[model samples]
Target: MASLTCRADCTHPANHRHLRFVWLYFTTVNLSALDLNLLLVFHTVLEEKTVAKAAAKLHVTPPAISNSLSRLRAVIGDPLLVRRGRGLVPTPRAQELAPRVATALRELERAVGDDRTFDPATTRRRFVLACSDNDQIASVPHLAATLASEMPLAQLHIVSIDQLKASDGLAAGIVDAAVVPTAASHADVHAEPLYVDHGVLVLRKGHPIRAPRLSRAQFNSLRYVDTWIVLGRAGVGTKMMDAFLHRHGLVRNVAVIVPGFAAAAMIVATTDLAVGMPMRVAVQLAKHLPLRVAKIPAPAMPIEMQLVWHARTHEDPGAKLFRALVADAFRDKPRR
Candidate 1:
């Protein structure tokens, strides 16, 4: 079989157009003789851009990946990928076929029940979840414990919610799910309300401003320590707090800004500065610190956290199991 000769710059606009035309020409070629598993190997290698990385991702040996690539090259009648400098780059044909092959594979998996028979105890699938630091602190322990008992072979990869693209990550297969405040708006993204959380003020025990009931004026006069950790696009609870104060023609002084909730708690526990956080989280922190929780002196600012995922994997057994586990872990705990 004659190999297809193409430029290495597969992502070039002109090359992409040419490859689209090539795709039409190759459509009539018999693919029944091709092993479907080799196509999967080709897809992974093209995505990872190196045999070693692809092998690691697929849980296979480097030699296995190389053998699969050889079979794929023979079947596709193209080099498919070529070494460039120290790394490999997909040929124009591979780039053109990549999306189509991935979509076809997803469709085939859906048709075949998408590993509906998945056994968490036996399977070693790794699931990636995106969430903020606070959620990690509050929920990860419970989640890890549950997984250890129920899905010993399964692994969990936690990525910071601030760094995740949410819906886009789900679509690209980078993240299996996300725990975020705002559900992504993409059509393929599905969301479920996980829990409703509310904020309370935290201050050091026996602070000068210590009072059984904080008046709105007292709340506005206090210097505050603000944490900037965000689980979604917007700022953490600050906007809501500011809006409430604005309604009363009042504003609290932000004495300092910290990167995380734990640091904010530490600062509040040792200093006169006050911090507002989720009631459950604040209560949890108070046990170890000389801190006390107080009402926000107004209606509680409700924070609705949600579980989000791509619709494509909604029916996958592992994804379903993970979603259930997350819900159980995050279900509201009685405030201490």
Candidate 2:
């Protein structure tokens, strides 16, 4: 085959890379003998760094992926991956081909319109959802119910992720989607509004600070159990609350710093430590825990939840349906 050149006339300058991804293929590959599926396995193995993980992501058996890897190694005439301790590490050749292979696969999938093949009814698959502890308690049941009705045989695997790195998880297929506080726009991810509410101060029902609201002096006297309410700039751990306190020369003392909303809620319910979180979640927690909700003084922490997914799965029909189910499950206006 004659050597092929990359895009010479693509009008969009930014898309020059997609055409370029093919250059590596045409330069060295024989069209008739190359198995695109093998390339998919190759890309997945590289991304996952282990055969078992790649197999799980591709919904295939580990031995099947191992055999595919052997075949890809033979086809590429390189040890594309080699065992290093417990995980596989890509060879330098694979490292060079990694991004190109990913981009090329994406472009090919686009050209081939491969996303239409996803049939939720018949496809028994596992989907991972990333969320905070509160979402796990307050939101996952509804999302799971929706998933069961739509894709009865499918499995839902819920996991916790650092809010700042949730998009990275989506991009890597670590999680199919995330339910989180609204984030700034990113070029590679899509975020849709899930719900909106304000923060409430969570406390034990018979606490000393009995008012429905707090005066600055009362607020300052209270000790707090700080927690990362998972990635929202809305309050407490972020500037939204600290900056508000700064204007009034008020300060909150941290009695404890827990990792999750649930833990913070527990500590606050048993002790006098107060924590601020979304009103909807607070009310839900109050129903089960000895918790009470109060407004976060003035300028309550604004809570805007969003459903996020990476562009890699943007056109996927199953992913689309999953996103819709999540949106439907949690998009209700906060009742209090």
Candidate 3:
């Protein structure tokens, strides 16, 4: 016969149940009775905070969630849910069960998370990642070097995109992950912060507009060489710049709009146009061109770089390990 087991911690109002969780332990119910599935559902419901959302997450109907909550209440002898606003709120008892229940569930999940171990040294899986040209030039080199030396069989494919995602390409697995400015909106997607970058103004060293100190007015008056590539691949830079200009009631005369920073740099070097780029990128371009970098008197508007991945892959052994490696490689190494 199946039986339900109640832990002492479940005595709280929030964790109390109407339907006792049933567990079959070797066809006997002498000392233990617990339904692990119900606990998982309970956890999801608490996290979501609404029965409808929990049902959607679990692929069930709202009534099923209510029934489970009823059972939980009866088993624990407490009104686990009380009406508040348009939803049910957990009481003090429910809050106490949260951490302990979560810890126990995590321990169980870790024990069953993977059936086999991943050996990066021997695996030959190829990873495809989408990122900007700046990331390709500045970021991938170190990753390539490490993978080549350590995981010899692993190959990395870098896909350069002008914008992060115009649609759900990443959701459909068109790309494994991307370095995006903002986290993807999909509930199943996750973004981990990598680094922050700031912008700088660049121009020819001897240009007339290259004042010892370029005021916002002087900076706006000069013809601007705009990079059409759009930082973070979604016209993010254009939007950010436009907002700042609007706030200050300034407008730039865009002399040219090119598809890349390289093109913008080339135009700025040969013409009387100024370009705005991240400090590191400007420094890099300066090495090969006759250009100089100028500090914007305004406080640098910093943008964060994040590693965005699908939620389904978040817990994968290989993906997690590789993500750790990538994060460590890009960890804030301030420019000397």
Candidate 4:
């Protein structure tokens, strides 16, 4: 891995000819000898146009920039830049490569910015995300719909994880982001508050609970369908449900305990069992689904949803864009 990283001087007409010979040798001979470092220089020169300006930006001497240009011409097998008046004008090949060159540099910039942060609009990137099935039913859909309008090129791959394995997906880079209910205590990961959703009771449009007076006693006596996992709590929803029942001095006879919210909602809507779920999700899906959400009179149990990513992908443009869009959609008020 020895690299002819950079060179700093080229003046004589004969040296230009020699650089041309190097270019011919690369094209007519082996391409592997072509130096990757020269591409960086070519990108700088392409952006700057002037050798002195590119050198100044790269923190190198003007001759170094020229030598880099010479190497670039050799490796690319093109007179990529031709002197025109006081500046260098790109040849056809250089013109063809400008966009690709710029994109490469931008990727490098992002990688350096924050283990490679991302931008959304201009980035044609795909990100993998692991979330519970409940997220697919709730958090992910709203964000995906928003992104479809704002960033059509940005694609999200959603993987369902029921057993709570947030760290593995992130560490393996298989999942760029994870929307988990619990906060990440891992030092290597970055987690931020996406939003907090309070639990709500979902009943049919004409259910008895929708009456003007809803009582805790009526709630406890009714058969209840519950999910095993509460977004933020461990031991699932059992402990949290117990705490709520304790406040009422009554315990809910659990008719069924399912693995996810969608299931609970499905079971509750068709049957007499009352289902407790995140308020926002219940409300959002209410119009389409045959369900209505009612406020629980006891203490409000809010579940905190967080966005987690490895420290590596925090600064990626696409990741940052998706994160911002998710946050904005879930915020107390939508900005737009």
| Per-candidate TM-score against the hidden true structure | 0.65, 0.64, 0.59, 0.59
The list of candidate 2 runs beyond 4 A from truth reads: 1-119, 163-167, 229-240, 334-336
RMSD of 1: 12.8
Per-residue alpha-carbon lDDT of candidate 2 for residues 81-121, written as tens digits (9 for 90 to 100): 99999999989988878766666666555556534687788
Which 10 consecutive residues of model 1 have the lowest summed lDDT?
A: 1-10
In model 4, the runs with Cα more than 4 Å from the true position are 1-124, 161-167, 182-184, 230-235
Candidate 4: minimum summed lDDT over ten consecutive residues — where?
1-10
Go through the candidates in order and give each one's C-alpha lDDT: 0.74, 0.73, 0.67, 0.67
On TM-score, the candidate that comes out on top is 1
| Number of backbone-clashing residue pairs for each candidate, in the order shown | 0, 0, 19, 12
lDDT of 4 by residue, 1-336 (tens): 011112322343443554454445456745775554466677777777898887666554576567667766766678999999989999998886665554444444443543444455656777677766656776677778888888788777787554236324564355777777765487457887777777777887667666533587777768888678744345565787778768767567888988777778777778878877777778766867788887766767777877787765676667677767766665656565
Q: What would the per-residue lDDT of candidate 1 be over residues 19-127, giving only the tens digit for each residue?
A: 4543454455645646566767777777678988876666545766787788678766899899998779988988878766655544444446424498888979898
Clash pairs detected, candidate 2: none
Q: In angstroms, how far off is 191's CA in candidate 2?
A: 2.5
TM-score between model 1 and native: 0.65
Angstrom error of the Cα, residue 160, model 2: value is 2.4
The root-mean-square deviation over C-alpha atoms between each candidate and the true structure, in angstroms, is 12.8, 12.0, 13.5, 14.6
Best first by lDDT, ranked: 1, 2, 4, 3
Model 1 shows how many backbone clashes? 0
In terms of TM-score, which candidate is stronger, 1 or 2? 1
